[model samples]
Target: MNNNSNLFLCKATRNTYEHRRSSLLCQVCGDRNARNCFGSVSCAPCKMFFRRNLDFDLVINKCIYDGNCEMHENSRHACRYCRFKKCLTVGMKKELTRPPRLNQKKRIGKQITPPLIRRLDLLNSNRSKLSFDQWSILSNVTHVYDQISPLPKILNSLSQSSFPPKKRLRIDGATLADMLGLIYRSIYSFLERIPDFTMMSIHDRNLLIERNLHNVGSTSGLLILRDGDLYSNYAFCRANLNTYGSDNFEGVSKLLNRLDMDRVAVKLFVVVLAFSTCFDVVRPSNMTNNIQLSKSTNRLHFNTINMFHIQNKYIDMLFIYMVYRYGYIEASLRFAALLFTALQLCVHTMEAANIQEHGDMLDTIIADTTRKLNVEDDPVV
Candidate 1:
């Protein structure tokens, strides 16, 4: 608290080594803290500790069961796996360093965990979502009408302090061309609706909107739009393409068509975005432990279950965003998308009742909206 005090109050070790050598890091972990706290990189464990427990939990449980909790870097022994999990939740890459393979050649490389593998697959999974399960069961559900529109009882349930603790998730995706088609339509509709003047020029808007469209197609998910870098391309697209032909109409149309082929990328962006909305992905620490921190379940097991529920309500939440982030997504599109998916599964179980054509609350929305909008303005409305 005083100027006399040093920056790092060392309890175990100091930041400098005895030699004349110095690293661009603190002796303890590398990098300066009281400085670039966020940008500073340390070994895996320390990074995790800083990320997860920065605020400091009032009630931290120690892992006295066995000082087995590795203190290699950021291992905060004062808890269950919560500290480590917090790190990843905060964006610390666990497998960042890739520990060396068995140097002795005496044994095979360490087997990777399913969760870790799942994480990798999610990050780099490029499989085709060429087919979708029967749509009839999943249709009636809509993000606005079914799950997200109203403040659902479930969300309120979680917020209730009087309620018993939060329950862990138990339950828990693709079709590419159709996926791209839907997202493209949404983007197209979004662009078409933009007022003329708000744009630097229609050409400028077109390129930005076009690139936005292309990014979605290329990534096949709505999250594609979130990347600031990709969206900027639209600005340049209009500037360059406009100059290339300066109002050449056919050139513009050709560009649209060129981007259209990236429907896979766009659709993938939506799919992934939909998945996030469908699930919390990152389970809260208390919630995770309460639910059973099955070390066996790979990282994605958490993400999978989170997104699945989100899908249950909207089934179309992410798709809605891909189509049009203007309204539904800003409003918890993913939450509904996942819930709708669940509603479909519920239909399967109630098959004897023939629940396929029977629409849920979402039908009410369509009916209500349809009544107000006349035929001429109907589509726009």
Candidate 2:
């Protein structure tokens, strides 16, 4: 394929998997092509088709009810709007845009400002490189969104909620959704730093995310205890965990079990390990201190120093959010600070992975991705 065509494929694939947990299936046709997307797993033809539509921002489609378009399966090639909408719903953020304003470096000026206020400014905003995108999206949408989607209301309520002034480790209450959000955000940030992997084709990248989500979400045997009331107590973790692992995935017939094909955690871990392995960053086979994962009731406990480093940073964001949600407004600012620190580490971790180890074909990528985004500097056509 031509360089531009290759670039288009990579950008489409990247956008498709953005912000999605691996377990979330493909939006277009629900094909579980999280990884190893070639041959029966996913044909090159289909991938090319998807990219072509994305490259041109042609979301609407009119299916003939025949197998011709072959848009995976049951894909509503009939409605560009619905197809694109579904794509966004599944994880693609249609950030295909124009030139972004140069971020003014505030610290560039020596204006004497109180350190606490400056720090608080960073905290209120998610310390994410993707912050620009977040800000743009949040600013564009009003408090109300498409009536069929509840995401707008939820996000608005969250933004309206106040952050506690103090910091502390919380355990009184926590919700799974909060946990999922923190974890998802952290991982995405981490992955973003890896410049090497940043250039991967969409199918390969999505596979890593999809499989890892399955692994983490499907870990069985661990009990997730929840909030209690006068009558009895509810175990949100247990319930949610059970729900995540309920899908029957047994009898592996391929290198990847068809049933449990795309476990997100497993996929994510594999990619990280692969990236590490590719660059020879961390070697389990060579290291004396490295420990292999253990399986109990077929689930890794996910206990590792790195996990502790990552989890400790934001688990409290979860704890605090839960506490406040259940009526504890006077919570602490500990998690806020931790998440801030974690956000920095998250970026470093991704850079450490550097998906670019795959190749140096990165300069061309920004332009294509920008064009898919439809910005001025980078023209896709």
Q: Which candidate is the best by TM-score?
A: 1
- Candidate 2, 1-381: lDDT as tens digits: 699999999998888766453544444565654432322122333344444445434333222122132233443333233444445444543343222342244444445543545545544343232235433433222111112222233222222223331111111223334433333333333444444345554433433343232222222111111001000111322433333332211111111111221122222222233232122222221124344534221122222343444433333333433343322322234334332332333333234224332112221322233333224224457
- After the best TM-score superposition of candidate 2, give how far the Cα of residue 113 lies from its true spot, in angstroms: 59
Instruction: Report RMSD (Å) for each prediction in the order shown.
Output: 24.8, 27.2
Clashes of 2: 49
Query: How high a TM-score does candidate 2 get?
Result: 0.19
CA shift of 55, model 2, Å? 52
Please report how far candidate 2 places residue 313 from its true position, in Å.
27
The digit string of per-residue lDDT tens for model 1 on 82-170 reads: 44444444454534433355343434344332234445444232222212531322232222112221112322221233422221111
Identify the runs in model 2 with alpha carbons over 4 angstroms from their true place: 1-175, 216-381
Model 1 weakest 10-residue run by lDDT: 167-176
